[model samples]
Target: MVNSLSKRCISLLPIYKKVPWKSIVLHPIIHPRFKFTCWLAAWQRLATADRLLKIGVQVPLECSFCNNAMETVEHLFFDCSISKAIW
Candidate 1:
């Protein structure tokens, strides 16, 4: 009965696709903090200004480092000039 209940519970849970970056982001050798950060970024769940604004928090939309565009996971990691320089 327990086994059947567990299977039913699991079946009720949401399904997600296999993310391509999971292996790289969750490598055993990676630091836990960095791994969590990468996980949030990979899911586009990082609390960037744009995301904060969506939840009604008042914050400037500009990128803090480059001020060229809205702060977002993509801009912070790739599109921002300052981040590109640092990387």
Candidate 2:
């Protein structure tokens, strides 16, 4: 047990939650742009309007489709009713 614990190779395995990539992001025929979008969405790093506004971009900061909430990456992609409908 001590030998296995001391092996650097054994410590290199992933220790985080597994991403569900096979069914979603790994289809051979899926468009590359869509794959990149999925990767960005997973990280909540998409440059939505609200994020741009905070960074000094001059885009409108309201959800254009929802019209009532701040247009953030999370709001536009996860919490908006329109986004839910599309998903």
Candidate 3:
């Protein structure tokens, strides 16, 4: 199965491992299975593919913890005000 898929992406054969395939294709970083499901859901609510940057229609974009920097998918999970509080 891996070999068949690899053949389809032959042009990317050289540096596939370094390409963040899980994050780029499978979106594992965004859809983590268990531990961070709640956090992931929060991120999804904020930045679904069809809703990217269309913040005004939904909740405000400010960080819930800081009330400052825009609450993007990347920021909330990795670099936001509440992360420090939780840690």
Per TM-score, the best of the predicted structures is 1
Comparison by TM-score, 1 against 3, better one: 1
Instruction: Provide the global lDDT of candidate 3 against the true structure.
Output: 0.60
lDDT tens digits, residues 3-70, model 1? 99999999999999888998989799999999999989988899999999999999999999988899
Who is ahead in TM-score, 1 or 2? 1
TM-score ranking, best first:
1, 2, 3
Q: Which 10 successive residues of model 3 have the least lDDT summed? A: 16-25
Lowest lDDT sum, 10 consecutive residues, model 1, at 17-26
lDDT of 2 at 43: 77
Q: How many steric clashes between backbone atoms does each model show?
A: 0, 0, 0
Using Cα atoms with residue i matched to residue i, what is each candidate's TM-score against the true structure?
Answer: 0.78, 0.64, 0.39
Candidate lDDT values, in order: 0.93, 0.81, 0.60
Clashing pairs in 2: none
Alpha-carbon shift of residue 52 in model 1 (angstroms): 0.2
**Deviating ranges (above 4 Å) for candidate 3:** 1-56
Write model 3 residue lDDT over 2-47, tens digit each, in one string: 9989888996657644433334445555545542555445446545
Instruction: Give candidate 3's error at residue 56 in angstroms.
Output: 6.8
Error of 3 at 12 (Å): 17
